[model samples]
Target: MSKNLVIIGSGGDARETLEAVEAANQAGTADYKVLGFIVEARYGTPGALVSGLPILGDFDWFAGRAGEVVAVGAVGSPVLRYRLVERAARYNIEFGNVIHPGAVISSSVRLGWGVIVEAGCVLTSQVRLGDHTHVNLACSISHDTVLDDFATLSPGVHLAGRVRLGEGCFMGIGSVVIEGKQVGKWSVIGAGSVVIRDIPDRVTAVGVPTKIISSQPPANWITQSGEK
Candidate 1:
């Protein structure tokens, strides 16, 4: 039997997630009957179509139906994704993972709920991805890498062996993290940057070898409007 599924978001990431789900179903790896998207009332209107799927409703749509449907978070921002997951939790909704059929994931990799591994991603041995982690296209995670809850990896990012990414860390597109390096919680790595050393929490780092540019409180990232 196919399980009912809903994606939480109406943006590009949500559409890409829908494509991944469809690809998984086509490959016979998943049996999900994706109903539609669930977004905030302010962001989406009920009955609207997104990538040919209806905007089912807001988070309130999960009310009284939590036992019948499972959801996955698809936003690009780790903090925003975490916020949506928490909102869904208020209605007792359970989360599910979406792995694109094109990705290469090792059997030893450990994935948590609401995780999304997009097409062309390569997760090597013993990679542990915590709850609600979003790994975008063509990224490579090397052996023994650990990504804590709400981590986001942009397209073409590469992590060497033994890398550790703390909660809600965002690795920009084409970024590279060397072996044994750690990026702390809520930190943002700029695009095309090369990280060689450990990065502290709640800071924005950029350029070659990654220099810390600025730092902000958790509230700055985890805002109601989902803006930094």
Candidate 2:
């Protein structure tokens, strides 16, 4: 039997997640029947259509349906995604994951709940992806790479062997991290940057052999209203 699933977000990432679910279903790798999207009340209206799926309601939509449905966070921002996951967990919601059929993942890879590995992604042996992590289109994670909770890898990002991304880190599109590097929690690597060394927490780095361009406190990234 197929289980009911909902995506927590109604934006482009959510639609792309829906497509991954559909592809997984078609490939016979998953038996989930995606019901719709559920976002914050401020972001969506009930019955609105998104990529042909209904905007079921807000987080409150899970009030009586937690036992019957699973959810996956699809927000693009790592901090926002973490906030959404924590919010949904209050309803005792069980999180689901999406692995697009086009992704090639090693048998030794370990993935946590709510992780999304999109099309053309290649996760090599011993890779570990923590809860609510998002590996976007065409990203490549080499052997033993680890992505902590709510980490976001933009399209075409590449991580060399043994790299570790701390919680809520965001690697921008086309970014590259060399072997044995560590990106600290909530750090941001700008698009096309090449990280050759370790990055500290709550900083933004860019350039070839990336440089720390800016830094902020945790409160700046995670706000009470969940806005970045």
Candidate 3:
């Protein structure tokens, strides 16, 4: 039986997920015949197609059929992806993960549901990746790293041992987090930055030692003076 799958969002990450799904289909390791992608009616691109899969409908239109399909949140923005996932959760949408053909994941590593691990990525022993997290192309996550839900690592990001990343965080391409560092929720680590210490929640940090720049309030953070 060809299990049906529908992807959410229409973007670079979605395209990559399509490729991974194709790979899975070809190998028969995963059973999925793509029904199409679902997006907002205004953004669904009515006649537009991805690899011959039509844009199904708006999320509301698609909700009734979610029970018969598997889906993935393929947006690049960690914050945006989390929001999307939360929306889908109301419909009890089941999220499927895309693991590229060449990534190496250790048996001791614990991967949560809805995660995507692109090619050339390495997950060492005891690593824990939270739900909806993305480990992009060529990234390396060393032993004992814990990446929270909806966190993302752009291409070539490297995370050393025992590093902890909070929910909805984004690590820019080539960013490097040294061992024993922890990044707080909703933080952004710019490309090529080196993290050596703890970063506060909702802050954007850049530089070798990763000093916090002025951080805006997170979507859920309500306060005038950075206070909880």
Count of clashing residue pairs in every prediction: 0, 0, 0
**Per-model TM against the reference:** 0.96, 0.97, 0.92
What would you estimate as the lDDT of candidate 1? Answer: 0.94
Q: Cα RMSD (Å) between model 2 and the true structure?
A: 1.3
The digit string of per-residue lDDT tens for model 2 on 28-143 reads 99999999999888888899999998999988888977789999999999888888888899999999889999999999999999999999999999999999999999999999
Clashing residue pairs for model 2: none
Global Cα lDDT for candidate 3: 0.84
Q: What's the C-alpha lDDT at position 165 in model 2?
A: 99
Off by over 4 Å in 2: 219-225
* Candidate 3 TM-score over all chains jointly: 0.92
Of 2 and 3, the candidate ranking higher by TM-score: 2
lDDT of 3 by residue, 15-125 (tens): 888888788667765777877787767776766887777887767745676678778888898766766676676788788878887788999998888888988999999
TM-score of 2: 0.97
**How far off is model 3, as Cα RMSD?**
3.2
Error of 3 at 120 (Å): 0.8
